[model samples]
Target: MSKRPYSAANPSPDKTAKATVDAVKDITISEKASDEKKDDESKKDEKKDDKEVSNFVMPNYLDGSFHWSYERLASAALIPLISTQVIYGAHPVLDGVLGLVLPLHLHIGFDSCITDYFPARNYPRANKYMAWGLKATSAAVIWGCFEFNTNDVGITELIQRTLTA
Candidate 1:
């Protein structure tokens, strides 16, 4: 065997027989840690599935309207949208992306007040339309604020193609 000097980055120690045992023990610990991480990821996946299911449950509207009123819904969204920028100091672009990508977060808060706010009760229906509208609006609002419609060359080209189409 070729001799290699002790490197701290490696588990092996040099100049002592005990170093071999230490290296073996270190390997076992690392393997155990890796196994634990796999277990954690499996657990996270399970939780994610559960959350997805719960997110789609129909609301308790109970009558001609939803659980909340339009005014109340608007106020609810206003709080978070403002707070995210004013208090939490989220970048406007990042905030807008979040607003588009996960519009449901804001939608849910507002749903407590809006009669029409529902999740995917029927695919490509009311809830789906609302979600899509919110996403589009969020993107437009963010891009407008950032002057992206004027400043972004890529967006301008894409817009030209869309307009031509």
Candidate 2:
């Protein structure tokens, strides 16, 4: 029996493929280092972003006389507008239904509301029940609008079914 001498140009010292394994390990380490660097950079930016956002301060409305800056009014109005959409669902009756659905806009009783029909009277039981029912139905309509893919036709038909029900 005999053992071979070392060779470098075409190395195969142990024949166990240690060099291939070492190359793979080095590649994995380099990838891990790059990932760590990315995480560090993102962490730094997150802190800087928080500081930048904190700089945009606002005073309270408890000061004597009232005033609305563009930012203030816009913020105030935006919430109710978004809520109105979620509250009432799509406007099948009119295009730009945001404009029409507002009580002030499309006046008379043609500006129908479930609130109008199921008026909140003084009775505790009826009032609570009606409130729950309306909320559930409104939530259903909003969900249905999101789930449905068709145009206003399907929604209008749905409204008709609800009205008949």
Q: Scored by CA lDDT, what does every candidate get?
A: 0.57, 0.53
Q: Estimate each model's TM-score.
A: 0.24, 0.26
Clashes of 2: 0
Give the lDDT of residue 162 in candidate 2.
82
Model 2 TM-score relative to the real fold: 0.26
lDDT by residue for model 2 (68-121), tens? 343345345546664654566645433233332332221222212423564446
Q: Evaluated with lDDT, which candidate comes out highest? A: 1
The clash numbers for all candidates, in the given order, read 3, 0
In model 2, the runs with Cα more than 4 Å from the true position are 1-13, 55-104, 107-165
Per-model RMSD to reference: 23.9, 20.5
Worst 10 residues of 2 by lDDT: 103-112
Q: Report the C-alpha displacement of residue 4, candidate 1, in angstroms.
A: 99
lDDT of 1 by residue, 20-135 (tens): 77889999999999999999999999999899878866655555245346435655665666555555453545454444434444554444333244645444477656656766
